[model samples]
Target: MPIIKSKIFTKSKKTSSFFITILFILSFLLVFINKADLYIGSKIKTVSADIASPIIYFLTFPFDKSISAIQNLNSLKNISIENNKLKEEIKILKQWQSLSLKLINENKAYKELLNVNDDTFETLETARVINKAPNIFANIIQLNIGLNKNIEINSGVLNERGLIGRIINIGNVTSRVLLITDINSSIPVKTLNQDINAIISGQSDSILLKLKFIKENKMPKIGEIIVTSGNADIFPPNIAVGKIYKIEDNIYYVKPFVNFKELEFVNVITKKL
Candidate 1:
């Protein structure tokens, strides 16, 4: 059995060797053919670049453009937001500027009121309005000045336009003014046109003092100016009170120069006649 197996192995080895030789020859021929036809370094590099460059460009072109567009859009949005913020800031500053101008004009008006000349009402003290009475029936105002500022009871209070009121009550640091429109208020007034003496009496809020004691035939006409007579030591002569607005048969009414609703400052004449 060993002899028979040895013979079979020898016959198979020849066939196997022939097949191996053919395979080696075929592999060598393929290698030589590939080397002769194509370059390994430069040619492979050129082909790879040609293929990859187009793919890279195709993938990155739109992405780069989109990135640039996004950056430009963000810049524009930032600029728009900043511009709006600046506009708002400018608007607020303009409001403040307008307020400052108004305050300056008001101060100038107050200074001019203080410089008013009157020898009879020599002693003068300035006071700022602080508050008003609660009801329409009580025409009283609270002032920042009081006895501490040399303001006394019965002190005449007047503004730039005309006579305002009298200081009826005085505290240490505050005083109460009784407006001329109060029912209890009474002052001697004279018409500038005819120089007719009359007693001015308060009626209501809108309607100020009515000129009394004038003869029915000698009533003042509408628009005639009324002024203090100086007969009473309480008020100075020639101080403008108001202008006549209406005359009904024998009675005449005058509208005050100063608007009590808009009163801000007043001068308290502390002089004793």
Candidate 2:
């Protein structure tokens, strides 16, 4: 019994030492990894994402369908209320529509007289939002369409409400969208009534975006509609972005039309190159 116990103790000690040695080596390797700029973590993340993306898509498919169905039902429920509001709006819009048509015809006549010709075309592509970043600091979403669908970088993304954001990164079957609420985002905008031009810049944690490049004397009024001016042609002209939310101490802020958290689908406008 004593010899048996001695042999067992020897084996146990060797096993424990073996594990301890392994743990020490692993600790050193991890410390070295943390200190060195080997970029191994980046590579690992890329590989893991590539392997896990399809699995995630399949897992979330049913949930997405359910959400879409619920949205449709809610929309149906609100249709009557919206219809009543639209009826009143349409009555006012018809008068403007008639004037707009008359003005368009007059403008065409003037352009013809001046021998000026302008022709431009735009195409829109649809993409599904597959993933949304839960981090408040990073206001971004991932789309299911990418290079396969010819989705170009920096293409304007929007829903029915108005301009949302632009494409930032593209992968094989996915793309990342930097929302208008992201700190890195900026857009050229103009107020509808005053025609006061300014740049809209995003905030880190706030949904109300900042208005820049506006003169203090030309502050846009509250409730004024803001739209893309296409100053640099980054986005198409006259795309409704949002409304002026507040003006205080020579500062202007806008409330976005599209709720960033609730986005499911978007239209990517691909301009002709």
Best by TM-score: 1
RMSD, one per candidate, in order: 8.6, 37.4
Which lDDT tens digits does candidate 2 get at residues 142-225?
989888988888888877677888899999889988888888899988888888888998997998888885555676678999
Superposition error at 31 for model 2 (Å)? 99
Per-candidate TM-scores read 0.64, 0.53
- The worst-scoring run of ten residues by lDDT in candidate 2 lies at 112-121
Q: Clashing residue pairs, candidate 2? A: none
Q: What number of backbone clashes does candidate 2 have, counting pairs of residues 3 or more apart or in separate chains?
A: 0
Off by over 4 Å in 2: 1-121, 135-138, 214-217
lDDT of 1 by residue, 24-74 (tens): 999999998888667776687899999999999999999999999999999
Task: Report every candidate's CA lDDT.
Answer: 0.83, 0.80
